[model samples]
Structures are given as C-alpha cells and as structure tokens.
Target: MKNLKLKAARAAKDLSQQDLAAAVGVTRQTIGMIEAGNYNPSLQLCIAICKTLGMTLDQLFWEE
Candidate 1:
C-alpha cells in the first residue's frame, strides 16, 4: 500500500523528498519509492526518517 501518511507528514513539515532524504542520508528516489510503496525501508532507515520528521515509527511506518 502507498505510504500517504509519510508523504503528508513530509508535506506538513515543508520538506521536499530531497530534503527529507538528505536528512535521512538517502537518495530522493528512496523517499519517493517509500511513499510510492515500492521500497521497504530498513528499521534504521525508518527510525532516521521518523526522527527527521519529528514523528514516531508508528506515526509514519505502521500499517493500520
């Protein structure tokens, strides 16, 4: 499934995919793929992304 929550949270924080990826030490394409559900990030990567966005793992990566 698409990670719309991640996309929305990134948007709410005024972060482009590039910005978020830079903060999380990944490529912009990685961020895009995550949002598009084409990539399944590692736990460390997920934590990095959550930290950069000021969100918890559940808030960003959990499937409801």
Candidate 2:
C-alpha cells in the first residue's frame, strides 16, 4: 500500500523529498519509492526519517 501518511507528514513539515532524503542520508528517489510503496526501508532508515521529521516510528511507519 502507498505510504500516504509519510507523504503527508513530510508535507506538514515543509520538507521536500530531497530535503528529507538528505537529512536521512538517502537519495530523493529512495524517499519517493518509500512513499510510493515501491521500497521497504530498513529499520535504521525508518528511525532516521522519523527523527528528522520529529515523529516516532509508530507515528510514521505503523499501519492501523
């Protein structure tokens, strides 16, 4: 499934894919792929992304 929550959180934080990727030490395409559900990020990467966005892993990566 698409990670629309991730996309929305990023947008609410005013971060572009490139900005988020740079903060998390990944490529912009990686961020895009995550949001598109084409990529499954490592736990380390997920934590990095959550930190950069001021979110928790559960808030950003968990599915209900």
TM for candidate 1 is 0.97
For every model shown, the clashing-pair count is 0, 0
- Candidate 1 lDDT by residue in tens digits, 2-60: 99999999999999999999999999999999999999999999999999999999999
**Whole-model lDDT per candidate:** 0.96, 0.95
* Per-prediction TM-score: 0.97, 0.97
Off by over 4 Å in 1: none
Clashes of 1: 0
List residue ranges in candidate 2 displaced over 4 A: none
* Weakest ten-residue segment in model 1 by summed lDDT: 55-64
Model 2 C-alpha lDDT per residue in residues 1-64, reported as the tens digit of each score: 8999899999999999999999999999999999999999999999999989999999998999
Candidate 2 lowest-lDDT run of ten: 51-60
